[model samples]
Target chain A: MAVTLKEVAERAGVSRSAVSRTYTDGASVSPKTRKKVEKAAKELGYSPNALASSLTTGRTKLIGLISNNFHNPLFLEVFDLFTRRLQEKGLRPLLVNLTDETDPENSLRMLKQYSVDGVIVASSTLSPEFAKAFHDAKIPVVHSFGRFASAPDVHVVGVDNVECGRMAARTLLARGYKHIGFLGGPKGATSTIDRRAGFMEVMGQAKGIKVKESNAAAYSFEAGRTAMLKELKGTHAEAYFCGDDVMSIGALSAINSSGLSAPTDIGIIGLNDMEMAKWENIDLTTIRQPIKQIVDSSVELVMAALEDSNRHPEARLFSCQVIERGTLRPL
Target chain B: MAVTLKEVAERAGVSRSAVSRTYTDGASVSPKTRKKVEKAAKELGYSPNALASSLTTGRTKLIGLISNNFHNPLFLEVFDLFTRRLQEKGLRPLLVNLTDETDPENSLRMLKQYSVDGVIVASSTLSPEFAKAFHDAKIPVVHSFGRFASAPDVHVVGVDNVECGRMAARTLLARGYKHIGFLGGPKGATSTIDRRAGFMEVMGQAKGIKVKESNAAAYSFEAGRTAMLKELKGTHAEAYFCGDDVMSIGALSAINSSGLSAPTDIGIIGLNDMEMAKWENIDLTTIRQPIKQIVDSSVELVMAALEDSNRHPEARLFSCQVIERGTLRPL
Candidate 1:
């Protein structure tokens, strides 16, 4: 039903190989022949079939952009950056929502079936095992927002969550919050474990400072609210450094409902500094994770891997900065 | 190198056709033959490639899930639903981000290049012409969260924005907001036009009630806040029916920053009761747009269109319901 390359070549009076070379990246073709082919292609409104050409080139140009936490507002930024970056490089994102998907074999098989050139598993909550599985299957995979690994098994791009944890703890302690709480995402996620580790590491040394810890079932608004509500049921800390902004917002809501105001009754701090954190209604004090840098680096690494799949796996970590807002008392 | 189907077939002691049929949906194959094929496939780590079969079947099972609004939190829910629903049907979502993309030809050519089975235009802000262009190109297209049309150029699955506007107006008036305003999304968007028309239609008849209109640049937090801040610079109405929740949240932020409270100072209502609207912190009073149903219906329509490309375009409109929360002044 659609115009074929053969027809375009015939109309252009050029060889079929000339037409193919005209559209193929880095393929050599005479300028005169390219002009003729382009005119004919435009006249016939023919687009080079990427899937058909992928069979010959053995490259689909499809990146399986896998993510599990679609509910997080931060994903709005993450996906936007990832897609735009991927597209700028002439690559398309095949969004794989592994939300509630545990088995890596099925997802690996599915992505392989689609013949995606590479996979970018972009989630902190999702286990590193998924990345390892894809890598073992011989698919080029980059884990964005993945936990920092000393001896990395896969290409990882994200902030040093442990350092961000320490930053949050210091930000609270400096503000004179004697009793602090670490309200984190799911206890199972490496992000939660690392952040908790850093928070405990800092608080463990502070003299006369008491610390408490609680975790949400998932990195969701409802989960954060439920965990905070449970904590508020008995004794609550003077300040709580929520793992991320969404959870911090949830904790703020619980505090609001409890007839108390932030920075006065119970100070709050969050990480990620998502767009919502800046909303006037929820002016949350938070830490800024360089999402753009992480996504950009991830894309660059994947492109490099596409060229050299045997590239050594490395961890690309960024630093976090505290974004003070109305959630905390002035130091 | 990936394992080929021939290798699996040879190992299973079955014809290649039998192996292909075992993987193909609704294909005839004996249970014993299927068992042998499955075992060989497992042992050889062979997965049927969608692109390879698409050459013969002419179906890629790849749906182009196109969206332009990645900044809005509401899209988190929309994307989650669309990806999950598409996956449930054994179809993969080829996510196309049209952010900053205005030319339909480029996107059309790209989707065609990938040989997607169908396209779902999932943005109300994007022009209906995009959907129409894809349809003209003979691609099955369904526009979700799009404008309603008695004679739609393409299949549209969303709510009646006109009715939703009237609901907001009536809700605000019932609460005794004598002077109301319409803080809509981009003026060019069909949602903004229909919503404003409905609001004006009801307000035009209300005796002794004054009404005004304003528009945000986009349905985003910053845009809404900026538009509302501009609105507050002059003589503003007693209440506003913001076109969507993100904009309403922006308006709420502006109102709060001005030291005015909702209901007492000004009443505000929003559409698309997104997850953030229900957050304990935001607790926005909004009209539910039933995003899940719209997405589900849109996927079903696209799948049906794949089966029968000649299917006539239809408009599937869902009713909106106002969710009572802390944003608005109670009657």
Candidate 2:
């Protein structure tokens, strides 16, 4: 059985209020009384209940970490960074997996029931409406890796997908590829939409350049491989710019299975320089998304929001850069 | 502002007890009063606080999921299955990252403060003493992927690493490998010790067979690759049984960097046929650990412990088998 505060008070021969004051932060209590209470508590193995004390402090220090993509290997890095950083700040993460969930009502209900001090939606595929739900309910929220907006309804921290798309297009053009393809993730996803728009914007302006575009069912390996297999059946493009690194790996596998290889028969470039992209056998040349900076900025924004709920929602965008590897031909 | 039960009751023209009963499971409330309370709560956007109600129910429905290895990709699959399964049971997972932590007292104190109903230590590197700490403090715990004991002090759910090692030795011998090597994880980890013991037990009895053994600093890719790079400087064995798949992938990368390949220049087999092992580029033949079954059984055991805290601890060992792919030479 857990040791109760009352038992510690009895053991210390002090009133319950004195024992409470001894534990509460910055609460006034004489050093002698504190030493006595501390000795008794240690002897009794008594730890104050955070939930009971939360009733008075009105702060639970719990953050709801909401995400939808578990299949993507990139999320492993994201979770590791988020959990470790939150733990350092003395905040516990209540993980909520919304893999197949579309509605926000169930998650909101659960978050409120737990009385989470704030929420962080760490997904690029989830719509802006999802994070807005928490804000509408007066819950402090920050959306990490969310779509970039000039004036976001909630605090947003991530890269500009449209600019990333433009960068991918310019890189391919510089490599002297006449015909290229865009193998993107889900068509309706904001990341895919913005990336496609920017790719088309640049490709359309370039003289005598032909571009074909297709999308995978989801941002997963099987989906990317399946989509690439269908593309390879016909006369495919010389090289392609894949949606993300995981999809690029999948496409590389499909090429290998079809008795072809990268940069020799088909060149590919991907975004999101996840850990897997750096492996020797899977040497994928890709654009790097600064995940650590994004996560840290999101946490800081949420902490600021908790201090002042009326703080205006701000958008923070980090720049993306090309990480040169062997998947694409040398420039 | 959060809508209180008193405001909800006043709006519904009912008593505070009626509003509380309407939300509490199995509580007494008339249908008319329940309808009125629901309408008022919906109008006021009120959700009952689980933490506050936990005082009366004495159940938080929160389970602490503790882990240490975040660099391993296999953990992505493990966390995905665990969070989804726990959510299905209406239990929320409070993720605790113990990446660099050694002492269990800190975790025990934090877990006690939140009053989590139970804990599941899902790590092979963590010692049995870690889980026993929770058991000694009267907190129900189940150690998934933990080392097995004949009469375990806490509920244990995982595969038998020793049998897996023996199976690896037999499989390599069947392939007519005369010189074999054992590349194990950290020396002090229970899983590593047990697996090495079993592998040695089988190899020691074979005649005219040479076995060389070494251990990596960690199970991560960098450690595996660095260890293998050093091993390649000498006359390495024809085949190696790596501790796990991540290490196997690392070893493969190392082999490639040293201008070698698998099944031709060198052969390798690994444990935990993780998702990446099946990719066409990395068709690693490995022993499958039945991760989904292990996770399901661990959740069930913890739920049972929740119902009866005094229940006797049991060990559930699942068998593992080799999943043939392209890494090992055909037998």
Candidate 3:
């Protein structure tokens, strides 16, 4: 049987309430009584139950961290940063996978059942509707790597995808790539749509530059490869701005297999400079999303919401910059 | 204020106990009362609080999913499969990152405080002492991807690292590579030690089969690249069996940068045919550690342990197979 507070109290020659107070943070207890309780607890190897204590304070300090795209390597960094940051602030992360979930109600129900202090939805593909649903149910929510709107309905944190798209167009044009293509992620995703719009906006005004566009089924390597392979079999552009690094890597593979060299024959640029993008064999020129800043701000916003449920929702957008690597040709 | 059982009881015109019985699984309740409670709950959008109900059932249905390595791409697939499987069985994953942790006592105390139903340590490099610590504290735990002892102190589920090492050595020999090498992970890691032991045993019995051994600082790509770069600066073996796929990719990059090619200048075979290993760009010939089966079995074992805390610890070992790819020479 596990050691209880009552047993520790008896061993310490103090009241059970005194033992509880000693373990509780911010609870008043005499220094001598705390010393006695600590010694007894150490001897008994006793750990105060967070669950039992939560019942008294009505605060479990559990934060539901929901994500759908574990396929992207970028999320591994996000998970590492998130778990460490949450734990640093004395909160436990209850990870929820939404890969197969389409209905926001199911996630709302799940988080509600757990009585989470707040939630942080970490996904670019999952609609902002999911985050708004949680907020509607009176749960403090922060959406990280989510699309930013002029007037966000929920607390959103991520890069400005449309501006990144414009930046990609400007970079390729400045390099004197006359014919360009936009190889984007799935058509229905908000990021894909916004990026396509911004790319079209810049290309439309340039009379001499010709632009073409298509999309992969998903943001995965295989999908990008399959889409690019089909393009290679037809009329392909001289330069392309792929959706993300993984897709850019896949497109590079297709080009290499087709006996074409990067930058020399067909230049490429991607977004989200994930860890693999820096690998020597797959060095990619891409936009850095500033993941650490976004995640840190998301955590702070969620904590603030937990304190004041009525806190107004805010949009936290980080700037993206082009990271120079091997894939893009010199200006 | 959150809706309570009392509100549901009042709306349904039934006793509070009746409303609880209607919500509880396998609890006895009249069909009329159940219908009434369901209507009232749906109208209020009330979810039976899992934490509050856990107090009475003595089951939080929370499993502590612990890991230390998030940089490896293989973990993305692992996390996807683990979280989806756990959720399907009505268990929530409380993700605990032990990246900076060296002491098992801290982890033990943290999990104990949460009153989690079980814990799963998902790392091959972590010491067996960590798993045993949870077992000693009378918590149900399954060490996924952990080294298997002949007589396990705790439930272990993964491939036999030693056998995989032997298999790698034999594969290299069959390919007619007379000069072989073992490039293993950190020296002190149980997996690395076991792999090295088996590789040496196999090489020792083979006549005229020269073998060299070196250790990488970690299971990551950089460590493998650094170890191989140092070897490339001098005389190196004709073929090497890398401890894992990420290391093999690193080694391949090192060879490429040195103006050499895999399977031509130096053959390399790695373990754990992670998704990246199958990519056209990487195309690494490695031993496929059945991660899916190992993960499924680990979940089943942990669930069984939760049902019966006294369940004896057992080792579940899956077989590893050589996956033919571009990295190794043809037989």
What digit string (tens of lDDT, one per residue) describes model 3 on residues A1-331?
5688999999999999999999777999999999999999999999887887776687889999999888888899999999999988989999999999899888789888888989999988888888899999999999998999878889999989999999999999889999999999989888998888888889988879988899999888998888899889989999999988889998999888889989888899999999889888988999999999998999999999999999888888999999999998998
Residue pairs whose backbone atoms clash in candidate 2? none
lDDT of 1 by residue, B1-331 (tens): 7888899999999999999999877999999999999999999889988898887788999999999999998898899999999999989999888998999988899999999999999999888998999999999999998999999999999999999988998999898888888988999999899988888899898999988888999999899999888988999998899979999888889988998878678888889998888887678898998888999999999999999999999999998898999878887
Residue-by-residue lDDT tens digits, candidate 2, A232-325 = 9988999899989999999999999999999899999999999989988889999999999999999999999999999999999999999999
Model 2 residue runs over 4 Å out of place are none
Best first by TM-score, ranked: 3, 2, 1
lDDT of each: 0.91, 0.93, 0.91
* Model 3 misplacement above 4 A: none
Cα lDDT for residue B283, candidate 1: 80
> Model 2, range B175-210, lDDT digits (tens) per residue?
999999999999989999999989999999898899
Ranking by DockQ: 2, 1, 3
TM-score for each candidate, following the candidate numbering: 0.97, 0.98, 0.98
Interface C-alpha RMSD per candidate, 1 decimal: 0.9, 0.9, 0.9
**CAPRI grade of model 2:** high
